[model samples]
Target chain A: MPTLYIDLMSQPSRACYILCKKHGLPVDVQMIRLDKGEHKKPAYLQINPLGKVPFLVDGDLRLPESAAIMAYLCDKYSLPDNWHPGSSSSSGQAAAHQQQQEQQRRAVYESAVHWQHLNIRAGCMRLVFHTVIGPRVFKVPAVPQVAADGLKVLQQALKDMESYWLGGGSRPFLTGQQVSTPDLLCVCDLEQLRMMVAEPSQPQLEQLLAPHPIVRQWMAAVRAAVGPALYDEAHGKLAAAVARLAAAAAAKPAARL
Target chain B: MPTLYIDLMSQPSRACYILCKKHGLPVDVQMIRLDKGEHKKPAYLQINPLGKVPFLVDGDLRLPESAAIMAYLCDKYSLPDNWHPGSSSSSGQAAAHQQQQEQQRRAVYESAVHWQHLNIRAGCMRLVFHTVIGPRVFKVPAVPQVAADGLKVLQQALKDMESYWLGGGSRPFLTGQQVSTPDLLCVCDLEQLRMMVAEPSQPQLEQLLAPHPIVRQWMAAVRAAVGPALYDEAHGKLAAAVARLAAAAAAKPAARL
Candidate 1:
């Protein structure tokens, strides 16, 4: 059995968790508490020099980066053809043509993952941190300019997601009819924004998500695809943490007086 | 044969060129001149809305992102087993174990490619643009603070590449003894910094490269792996462009007088 070291609060970690559960891969889930700073400690650093979350240890192999982990799992388990159709078990020109289409789909997914890293992932994470998490959880004051900048970039990404990727027609997901890993990675990031907006301290974040109907529809579809039980299980820690932070923020005025 | 829309000045474009030529894949290289803004034009924009270089068109499929392009080429051509050993033609536990090791190697390579995008690629591109390209080509004066910050980040990336990834001892390439696609991508970016340092105007850039002997050694190995004639063919345009820029920079003072 493989060991997966993860903290559910991290988007990539959550994605990896869902991917494993979705496929029914037998593995030990070792929770590395981020709040306890376990990930930054020397023990964790020894395993991964970068000391980042969602690393997989299978036999002698220690792998980090959610994209890499997901790709490896998809190959190792030989999961459904839809996940990575390029490696489909077929032959001849028909197979070659199918492989070409699959490669194109894979390329689009790869491009989205890379683009998400610099844009949506970075933008939404920063916005959530500056608006809600930094102030409420960490007790650090929010930087308005930085937060505003994050919101701006997030808005642009959402618009692009809706108009460019999703608006192409009746596609249920980012790539096509089938849900892929990039969809998993993307929806996780969007969930961060959704979580922050759910907090009572930041009603403004809701307005940021209000305009994009396509985003809402796609996110709902992702939720449905993941199923309610696993979705809740993956996000349970994060939801609870946000609730606790919101409650504390609400009680702060009474304590001050 | 597939048509590759590229500009040699772009690092990823050069990587794609080298990968195809190195593997002996049939490709029609259609050079898109960035200086003339060919990529931004309506015709190219219709093909790739993102308007980025190093995109591939094979029949109806339009693939972007160099990493994906390289992976697709590797799969479509079935160049070598080592290039993507995870997708080997075998089965059962023994094959699964071998696949596991191959996937681990692939994961490391994937992680490196993603890490390279944000760190080395972004940092070095910004550093060279601010310190060299912006001032020389665009007639925009260099921002000392921005250039300094870029140099700082790039130096840190170089140190990490040397000590963390390459320092494991006596490896001919990044992932292993054999040079992979990620190696091609990484070497191209380092070559950009190398090109800038070669310019008489930017002697300071040389200092950034001087401290890392491991980087130098790895780069040499990558060059050797690609072979001289093919390597020279791939880099010919970029070299000429750099030379032209250097000559133009040298002649500017005389013109002003």
Candidate 2:
């Protein structure tokens, strides 16, 4: 059995949590509350020097980064053949070609995952921080210029997702007909954005996603695939945190002054 | 044979070039010159809409990003078993565990590759641009503040690499005893810095690498493994470009005015 140290409010943590549930991998889920500054403490720092969420401890190996954790689980558990086609046991030239194609698919998946770190993940986190988190949690007033810049980057990323990655052909996901790791990773980032924008206090954030129909449809599909029970279970803490922030913001307007 | 579109000056492009040479993969090297604004031109833009170097064009697959290109080559060519342990043919729990460890190794590789995009790569690029490129190529004076900031970030990344990733092990390379793709990628970025710092005009840049003996030794090992002829061949264009830039800077004394 492995122990996963995670904070539900973190986008990658939610992705890893949902991935484990979706695959039926039984493991201990240890919550590290980010809002309570639990992740920054010395105990957590000893576990991960970076003090980040989505760290995995299995036997002798301790791993951080959600992408790595997801890959480890897929390999260690040998979960279904569709998740990674290269893992399939087949031979011949046709098999070779299939393996090549699967490798290409994985390359694309890896590229997107890597690109998301600076683009989607960074942009969304900045946007959320500037518009909501900074003001609500830290009592720092919103910086409209920074928020707008973040929104612009997010919009371009959404457009790229549609035109370059997903909009090609009739494939339902980032890689193919099946829901792969990249899809799960991407959807969780967008869900974080969706959570922030759903708040009545942030109408400007809502308009950023309004023109991207493809992004909207893809999010809905990912949500349905994860299933409501698991999706809610994974995202429930984040939702509660957002609600608390909103209530706190409403309660003390003078704190900003 | 696949066509690899690259600019040798670009760090990732250099990695892919060296990897292909090391593996003896027959590839048509097509240079997209960034110094001449060739990458930004319409012809190159059609090949890669992102207008980035290190794009790979195999029969039908047009892949961008060095990590993706490297993985595809490793898969399609079916190179040595050590390059990618998970791709090896084996059976049972021990094999499964080996595969798991390999995947974990790869995950760390992936995490570093992704982190480099924003940290080492971005920081080094900014440092180079602010200290060298801006003044020489663009005729723009270096802003001390921006250059200092970039230097600070680069120094911190090098420290983290030593303390967190490398200091834990006696392994020669990033993953293990064998040289892996992540090693190629990281070494190339460091090589870019080395090229810039080697110049007589950039004493500050040279000082940055002086304290890190581990990084220096690891770099020497990677260069030796890559061998002299192939390594120099891959980096020749970039070296020449840097020289020309330096000569041009000397020629135009009053450009800053």
Candidate 3:
């Protein structure tokens, strides 16, 4: 069994955790708390010198980066095609036409995965770190300009996701009908904005995703595909953080009276 | 034959061009100049809705993102194992030990590739745009603070590359001894800083790379591995841009006198 070092608060970590659970891939889950700086300690650093969460260890192989970990798991365990799409089974002995189609699908999937890392994931993390996590958790003052820039980039990425990946609602997920890892990674990253602003019932996620209905629909599809239980379980820490923020804001008004 | 749309001015585009040329892949190169706003035009956007350079079109398949393009080309052409390292051939009929080793290598390469997208490539581009590209090419005022932050991130990423990816000069390439696509992409991105500060004899590329000797060595290895003719051909536009900046600066002193 591979040991997965993850912190649910981290977006990619939760994505990997949910992937392992959803696929029934037996993985040893070891929590590496980012908030507590456990990842930066000497012991964890020994395993992964970069000191990032979602490090995977199986036998002699030590891997960092969530996307790589997820890909490795998909290949090793031979998960279903929909999860990664043509990534597990190699392109050996397939017909020429089928091989070409599989190559295209894999190419599209790879592009979306890379796109998520740079744009959607990077932008959302930038916004959350500057606005929510930095100020609230780390006690660092929020940089309004940086946060605003992040929001702008995030919105643009969402628009690109809708226009290019989702094909203006023509395709269901980021790549295709079957939900892929990028879909899960992207939805989880965008959901981080929920900590920014809360609506009457919904939070920043719903509002920020308001302009891109296609993206929201895609996110819903990915969540449903992963099932609500595993999704909630993986995101339990983040959800709790959102609830606490809400409770604190709700109490501030009554305390003034 | 596939068609590659690229602007040598763009870092990823140049990297892709170098990959195809070095591997001797038959590709029809279509130049999309960023200086003329060609990428944003309607016709090009029709081909690639994202309007990004380094879009690969093969028959009915349309692919964007440099890494994806390189991966697809490697698979389609069945390129050497060293270029991608276990990516070309499947794990069919391989011994269990060899399979595990191959998986580990592929995982590391994937991590480095994804890490480059978010950190090294991103930070370098951010710094260059804020300091060099924005002020010079786009006529946008340079944001000193943003540039400084970008520099900080870029330097940290270099240090991480040294510590983790390069393994303190233990590994010859990003993942292993053989030069990979991530190595090409990263070195190209870092070289973009040459536009910002030109040294007396050497340029900003050398000055910025001075602190990280391991990275400098790794870069020299990649350049030599790819051969100078193709590498220089791919980076010709960028080299000309850097030369133009130096010339303009030299002429400014005479004008002042």
Candidate 3 Cα deviation (angstroms), residue B6: 0.2
Q: What lDDT tens digits, residue by residue, belong to model 2 across residues B113-227?
A: 5556656765676677667777765577765544554566678877766666665447676666777777787778776765464244654434766887777777777788888
Worst 10 residues of 2 chain B by lDDT: B84-93
Any runs in candidate 3 off by more than 4 Å, and if so which? A198-203, A252-257, B198-204, B251-257
Show model 2 residue runs off by greater than 4 Å.
A87-94, A129-153, A194-204, A246-257, B88-108, B126-153, B194-204, B244-257
TM-score on alpha carbons, each prediction: 0.83, 0.84, 0.95
Window of ten residues with lowest summed lDDT in model 2 chain A: A84-93
For candidate 2, the per-residue lDDT at A22 reads 87
DockQ of each model vs. true complex:
0.34, 0.41, 0.66
TM-score of 2: 0.84
* Candidate 3 chain A, poorest ten consecutive residues by summed lDDT: A196-205
lDDT of each: 0.74, 0.72, 0.83
Candidate 1 reaches a DockQ of 0.34
Say which prediction, candidate 1 or candidate 3, comes out ahead on DockQ: 3
lDDT of 3 by residue, A95-153 (tens): 88887888788888989888898789878987788767887776777665566666777
- How many angstroms is residue B5 displaced in model 1 relative to the true structure, after the best TM-score fit? 1.0
| TM (chain A) per model | 0.88, 0.85, 0.93
